[model samples]
Target chain A: MSSQAFTGGHKASHQELPPEFQDQEESIKITGFWMFIVTDVLIFASLFATYAVFVNRIASGPTPAQVFQLNTALIETLILLTSSFTIGIAIWAMRQNRQRMVTWWLVLTVLLGMAFVSIELTEFAGDVAAGWGWHTSAFLSAFFLLVAAHGTHVTMGIIWAVALLFQLRRRGLTTVTRRKLYTFSLYWHFLDIMWVFIFTVVYLGGRLI
Target chain B: MHGGDEQHETAIEPGFDFISPRFEEPKFPMHQVWGYAASLVLTFAALWMTVNRIMSPSVLLGVVLAMAVGQAALQLGVFMHVRESRGPAWHLVPLGLAFAIGIGLVGMSAWIMLFKSGVS
Candidate 1:
């Protein structure tokens, strides 16, 4: 389908668009990705709603203020935020057809993402070893579910970035590859946006009186 | 009309084709740099406000939530290129509706569960 879309562009593309949108079908695919993001928005919304409900339900365990560490969460937040900026810059480089710049920035972004996931895992491990698991209370359950979901998304993103790096190597910058990278950047930024809320409503809100 | 029949069909064709395109003028990404800086400021401000208890608890919560929304908007526009389109920007319609529903879901759930709410 992608090859077909690429070929279709050369003859019929009247509108000068970014390389990703040079193919009409691929532009529709971009819109489809947006729809996918809309669904994701709802998915996270439900979890956030659940988290809000259970946030105060510490049956026999620590409260969020007791469990969450401001310093660590702040570091993780900044790392992920910087990775988001790096990916945005990567896409900017892709538009200019600078493969090396895009590749270097993507590598940096992936490394940052790995750092975030590892830090989160270590945090969770520390909690579990100290005997605070999701089973401890409704609040813990909600916290784990909401945050783990985002962590899982980040894990998946790391994998996707590695895969995209491979594709960029094999295919160089084509319309198809450009679209894929652009969509991934969109997903990354969306995740950061979600994290902004998580940092606010979950981490920071947990520290509130 | 170079082709009379083509022009005739255009006269009869529906205008609801959403596949319209727009030019994406390339420039230096100062937007990204400013967005990153602004986002950092917002994060630290939220943290500081939370830590210092600079306002009443509820008011601080409200302020931080507003900042989160602003940060999301900044990333969406500057980084995600939400307004750039090869289509009619129909995405903004669904994405907007999604936010409305998502925000309503979070706010309503928090409000409804006020029965279980208290200090951290």
Candidate 2:
């Protein structure tokens, strides 16, 4: 079936699969990664549910309106969005066999991701300094937990990207490296999608309500 | 050069013919460009609505949420290549189930918290 699928395409050639899907094993691994992403969806969904329940539980603390800075959120959104784009381009470059371009774009992605984390940390620090820490109210607690979870993910992604950069430098664009890069891109894009929800439901919706 | 080598290698193998142009994948990366533009438009539109107070809170919330979902679709379809799979694509089965379960988790939790009782 796999061979037929490879040959069935009109462009059937010796290389039937993309670099990332070059092997049946690699293809299955990508599918497994998707499953992992589904579980992550559930984790975030539960957090969203918790936030919804506590969004109104201010309890004599700073409200969402007072806390969320639209300009900052917008900037963060743009940064992450642009980083996602760069990573996509990186994968595209990798497919084109442009190893240097891939490394450069990946580095850019890591930088932008770092900027996002720093901005998020600044926001959290400001809140805590203003006596609006998570302990102040249920709303604040939910807010902190949800946003922090995302921030932690971004931090880890930066680390992962750096590691991938080293691998790309050392190994070039072999199938194994390509598969890893592809999965990393998927993970990065998934995080951006999650941020869309966070910006909408938490930051924007907080102010709207 | 690598592609030519692959074709030669496969030609020697039994039951394999030289790949035709019809089977060739498109070389352009236009999908990524389209996804990026769509994402930017959706993001700015949601931000504009929130900043300008263009609608009631409830209406704006619904619109923004809808836009978020659309953005996700664009990302999955274009950037993530979510449909690119090998074999029978059993992964999508679990993915579909996950989506249903996620929606149920969020929806039921919100309902229970907001309404206090399903029977009520």
Candidate 3:
């Protein structure tokens, strides 16, 4: 019975993975990363959907156009876009084995990321000070959740990149460093992408509505 | 140009293995160069449309949301390389979840718009 069960399990495994691609370690991790991205995508998608549901709700509160400062948002957008480009160049520097260039570029990216978050938080503070609290309306609640989620991710990305900088400083560019950098780039780009949506939907759509 | 000896340009032999780390700088720099440019244009164009509420409020809202979705797709597919990653099928799995989100959004919107006051 034990031998039969073993054979059955082997056959099941073989059916799942072909012979040539049977390596478990690398393929699993790559697939796992993809799955992780998909899950994150769903999280954002749900947020988007929620925003859509209550988009018209103001509860006699401030609307997007009245609340969101287009100029400030534009400034924040520029900051994030430039930082992404700088980080991309930093990755290129890493590829070229230019350590000092990498460090400086990453430092610039961190500062820019911080600048974006501070401006965003300031905008939120201004909103609250203007008597438009998160509880004021369904729209405000959804807006806070979505934008705050993205802001939190950016803050986390800055921290993660700085930590990577420290690791690179201590150990130089090893395979581990390369993998970390690759993951960080993925994250930074993801943040940029989410910003694109937030800017378009929240800022723009809110004004239009 | 001064290869008068038998050792011509073709005679040069690299010391390393035939398949070395192909670390030549990116040939198709278009992806790197154009990625952010496209993003900026899309973002600004969206912002321009939003500024001053350029059209009917409802229509503008819908357009902005649609454009945002497009922008997000560009960022995810191009910048994040989500679709081009090793296991794209795994990434595609979220489509189902997004569909569920759509259903939930429509349902919740209807509930809130049509029934929330009645229930309260």
Candidate 4:
């Protein structure tokens, strides 16, 4: 992969690509990327199922109906949903190979992500202030686990996006960088999907119960 | 012709190699009009329902979650090119998800048994 070779400037057709990359580079990358996504899907699936099984296992703690604030939860939900939209724009920019555009869109995505997390943390603090600790009961425990896990994923996504931003600057949109971004986009969207479960099981279900 | 003895061996080399260095579909296609319109309708409906108190609080929450999942899927399929990956690497995504679930379930069950067995 020299830039010249990649751009088809010099190498002859019979140059025989490097042995390791002669026949499986794209296949390998594709496989690796899909494997990563499948594993992640399984992880989120388990969380959803677990939350379902233990949703009512209050074990002498505040129930979801008692602890959840639907109004504020709605706001948090909107923030995250909007952020996902921004990230979609970022991916579109990447596809167009608009370097500056991608960079700016990612920056916007990172900012929105930070805002979502900050709002969530504030909400958590408010819950604590009202004396609803994670250990207060089984319901709260599950609540903390489900929502916090999703939060952690969002945080990781923000960090990943930022790192990729730097990589974009240093490496530009090379094939390697493009693949990396494609993977990260998958990851970011997956995080959004996981939050859907959180909103349903923890927030809405909690209130209904 | 550089190696004149290679004429017979040309059959050994496949034209379309499995490890093809080139990739054709570099970008995922976007249906901006449809995606935007659908998203707007969904969001507006969800918002109006929430504001007007049509759905119960819990139901509202569920609807919101569903909306998010829908939007995320749209982005992944349309913008991320996950489904377009040449190999089965998408399988790893699900596998990772399964392991994460296993750990969460086992850990939570253990905690419940340890602390709340008699109570609940």
Give the candidate number with the greatest DockQ. Answer: 1
Among the numbered candidates, top TM-score falls to 1
lDDT of 4 by residue, A1-209 (tens): 33233222112232332211122453366557657766666666565656666677777766777777777776776676566666666656655657798788778878888988998999899889988888877667767877888889889989988999999999897767766666676676667656655665566556554
Model 2 misplaced regions, further than 4 Å: A1-15, B1-25, B116-120
lDDT of 3 by residue, B9-111 (tens): 1221355222121122342335556767876786777777766567887777667667666666665554444432211133444544654665476447535
Docking quality level of the chain pair in candidate 1: acceptable
- lDDT per model, in order? 0.84, 0.81, 0.66, 0.61
Task: Name the regions of candidate 3 deviating beyond 4 angstroms.
Answer: A1-31, B1-29, B52-63, B83-120
Lowest lDDT 10-mer window, candidate 3 chain A? A1-10
Residue-wise C-alpha lDDT for candidate 1, range A48-154, written one tens digit per residue: 99999888789989989999998999999999899999999999888777889899999999999999999999999999998999999999999999999999999
Give candidate 2's iRMS in Å, 1 decimal. Answer: 6.2
Tens digits of lDDT, candidate 1, B1-120:
132112111121256343332333345768789989999999999999999999888889999999999999999878988865653567887998999999999989988877544653
> In angstroms, how far off is B59's CA in candidate 2?
1.8
Residue-wise lDDT of candidate 2 within B1-120, one digit each (tens)? 233233442222333322112222335667788789899999999999898989899889989999999998888777886656543345666776877887788778766776765642
The candidates' interface RMSDs, in order, read 6.5, 6.2, 15.4, 9.2
Which is the winner by lDDT between candidate 1 and candidate 4?
1
When summed lDDT is taken over every stretch of 10 residues in candidate 4 chain B, the lowest stretch is B4-13
Task: Calculate DockQ per candidate and list them.
Answer: 0.43, 0.36, 0.16, 0.20
Give the interface RMSD of candidate 3.
15.4
List residue ranges in candidate 4 displaced over 4 A: A1-27, B1-33, B43-73, B87-120
Find the 10 residues in a row with the least total lDDT in model 2 chain A.
A1-10
Decoy 2 TM-score against native: 0.87
Question: In order of the candidates, what TM-score does chain B achieve?
Answer: 0.74, 0.71, 0.57, 0.50
Q: What CA RMSD would you report for each candidate?
A: 5.8, 6.7, 13.6, 8.3
